[model samples]
Target: MDISTLLAQASSKWPQAAALSEPARDRHLTFRQLDQALTAFGQALERLDVGEGERVALLADAGIDYLIADYGCMANGRVRVPLDPTLSPVELLAQLRDAGAALLLFSPQYADVAEGLRGEGIRCRALEELTVAADVDLPDRPAQPPQSLASLNYTGGTTGVPKAVMHRHASLCAVLQNIVMARGAVLGDVLLNVRPLWPIAAVAVLAHLLSGGQVVLGGRFDSKTFIDQLAQQRVAFSSLVPTQLLRLLRETGSAPADLPLFKSLDIGAAALTGEVLDGAFSLFDGRIAVLYGMTEAPWSCYLAAAQMKALRQSGESAEGVVGRSLFAAALRIDRADANGIGEILLAGPQLMAGYWQQPGLTGEVLVDGWLRSGDLGRLRADGQLEVLGRCKDIIRSGGKSVQPGEVEQALLSHAAVREAYVFGLADVEWGEQVCAAVVLEGGASASVELLVEHCRELLSRYKVPRRLWFIEELPRSHYGKVQKKRLLEVLGVVAS
Candidate 1:
């Protein structure tokens, strides 16, 4: 069945159950109301004379309205182009043109940008206007096929030019199923989602609804508010990136005392450091689950809370252990080295159809049925998957290959370091010198010389950072993944 059918079935089975809520705005929708809203959005599209298979660019923050627009596109056989709100106007405009979006629906907060798009001769309107138009009666059309295009989600472009990953209704459904199974989602459960809806996290939100659970939207992820909302709603399941989880532990000092009903906390987007993992276990009582995947294939590997607790008890470092592949997913280590590290290859029903309008680029990644994940990883003896780093981010210094993650882990082992990012930079003699940017713990200090000595003890000479920069914070994407290429550009080092 298509996404529309899946949602419809959920709405029908639990018509009165809470489907979505935004506590910050005091907005809520029951299953029945949510289904009706989806229909209304479809009607609104019809009023705009937006036909099936046409692209609709959605530019808005994470909220009930954004969800409506996204599902509305899927329900009406329209292609959705969910633009990252963090992107600049130029970047957003480029995506709109690239996707050939028939209409641009934006939130009130983005009215200025929408007006700017209008000036560029693009058809645009405030999201609320669509809601108003949806109030009228409109006939329902036949359901789209499972193979129909559902979304055009853009990559973060950390490695190269960002391309939109195309997904069909079937692929999205598979991901939702994977999330539901991995998170133990159930009827009447509650999920507090603070991450933006434009990203893959939206699928997790949908998974809850499809499982007859309530999804409470926590807008913009304020540490204090997130804790309060969790305690207030008695949330059963939630998800966060590593950065958000770290900030929660630092800012709150401990977990909320009132989370008697909370069940699981899913962490994704980046790897968690050993220190952060310790803090998480101490504060949350070992309810942490680490998820690993990308835009093209969401939630491919899942490390459950039980496994996390086992690792902590055994004193094993979390490091790059992103857990086992989902039951339906297959993992392969391509061109493995002596230690078994290699580029990760994934094959699953959830893999993206391809890059939108870029067949050649898609061909590079999607070979046969396996998607060549640019990530380098290996399977551990314990059956867990250990992701080393990006294939593109490997540093070759003085003809010796150095995994930046390996050096960064050594630096992080030092007590003074709070956060660390290692990369390759240009050098006259080495061709590419290993460099690092570090963030120190509060009230902690360490000179580059001391850190270098510390690394020297743990790493090979070629792997140690030749240069180090101490910064208050590293640049990060909206989802908390470090933007390495952008970091180099900011440091005046040529992008690798």
Candidate 2:
């Protein structure tokens, strides 16, 4: 299953069942129509001589055309690198230059950014012009093996560099299998792929299309409509980050009309709080779940709704568990701190073949066929796993250690607190200070003293927020993960 097979399969099954659509644009392509669009884009890329294995950059808004260019690259054996278009030209150029990409494909809206890179000896083209009518003499490209390199998705590493996580066709196929097995996804499920496609889990949405399901395509995400879409499209499956889920649950109506048609809700891309997990589970009647994976390992653990419900019924909270392994993937909690909380290491076919062009870095983490996940966690005797926090996010203040996630959990449990992020800031006395920034629910405001007092009852005094600030909204990436690094910058908080 080269990723292209998904689109090919869909076009074969229900060519007229609306394969892709963006309601705002009044633009849609049936499976047959989608095939033509992909052919046109492939032919267009062929004319440009975008060779096999060459890195082609796609910086554009999410839509049907972007999907065309992505699979079109797969169809032509070219490795596609999808980037968030929100990046500044400087940051964008820095990555392109490092990738050694010969050709850049982007929408006309980003034409200025693409044009700016031309002076740097980088060939760039407007993605709008990347496609042409069927008459063009596009070169013939042969099919590629499933193990051929699929794409290099960039993610920030502990070293602070934008490391490319290499993924292959086989890895993606395993991911598809894991998704099908973990989610029980089926052909008739309506999927709204509203999250950015840069993250690896997003490939699962593409997998749904490949597995012959209805795909409601576009990057447009509106909470009101998102909640409405569940009933409107009768959407059975959907994926979103905690932030998007937060907004969706906060819709104006106490109980939105379409709140109940979902068969599955898979959330990832960031740590989901107990607040969000409880809210989502209760809202969907426990059809919601949290998927744990990274760019390097696409589908790893799955925490299903049943597990969460059981935990709650047993007087326990599904507080921090990311879930169990999916699709034969194995997980072992070998790291411990006298409490059995250690790093989670995994081994599976779904793991990335290696970091693209970063073998030294790959070797450092992938030891003996296992991925040494940098996350710190513990496995309960019953086998449910609880992720405490990333190794880097655990804060040490004075002599005691603090997991920022714990503080955040306490803050969000408050009815007035809509969202919270905790991190260590510089302090002359304690060596490091615990700080928090919260967004109140529904524009409601809370006194800083009152907020701190509430944390005193829910959290340890040391873990209580020393600094608290209210913001209209928290800064987030397109995929809805908080840009904690950026948030710290805005707060003028510096790590010691």
Query: Which number leads on lDDT?
Result: 1
Q: Where is model 2 poorest over a 10-residue stretch in terms of lDDT? A: 132-141
Q: Work out the TM-score per prediction.
A: 0.95, 0.87
Poorest lDDT segment (10 consecutive residues) of candidate 1: 132-141
Models, CA RMSD each: 2.1, 3.4
- Cα lDDT tens digits, model 2, 1-496, are 7666655666768777766767667777677676667767766776888777888888887777778777777766788788767777777777777677868888877888878888878898877786543454333345569989888787772224557777888787788888877777676667887876764545776667766677776456788677766677778788887777877777743342455557777887256766666677777777767788777787788877677667778987676777778877888876588989888888898898887678899998899999988888888888867777788777778878898878987888788998888888778788788888999987576899999999999987899988898887788865566788778778776655
Residue 234 alpha-carbon offset, candidate 1, angstroms: 1.4
Candidate 2 CA-lDDT value: 0.76
lDDT of 1 by residue, 1-496 (tens): 7888888888779988888998878989888778888888887788889999999998898889889888888888998888888777777778888889999999989999889888887899888776542444344445779999999998856234558999999999889888888888789899988887775667778988888899988888887777778888989888888878878887877653457788888887356777777777667778888888888998899998888888878978676788988968888899999999999999999999999989998999999999999999999999889988899889888999999888988998898998899988878799899999999988999999999999999988889899999888889865677887677767776754
TM-score of 2: 0.87
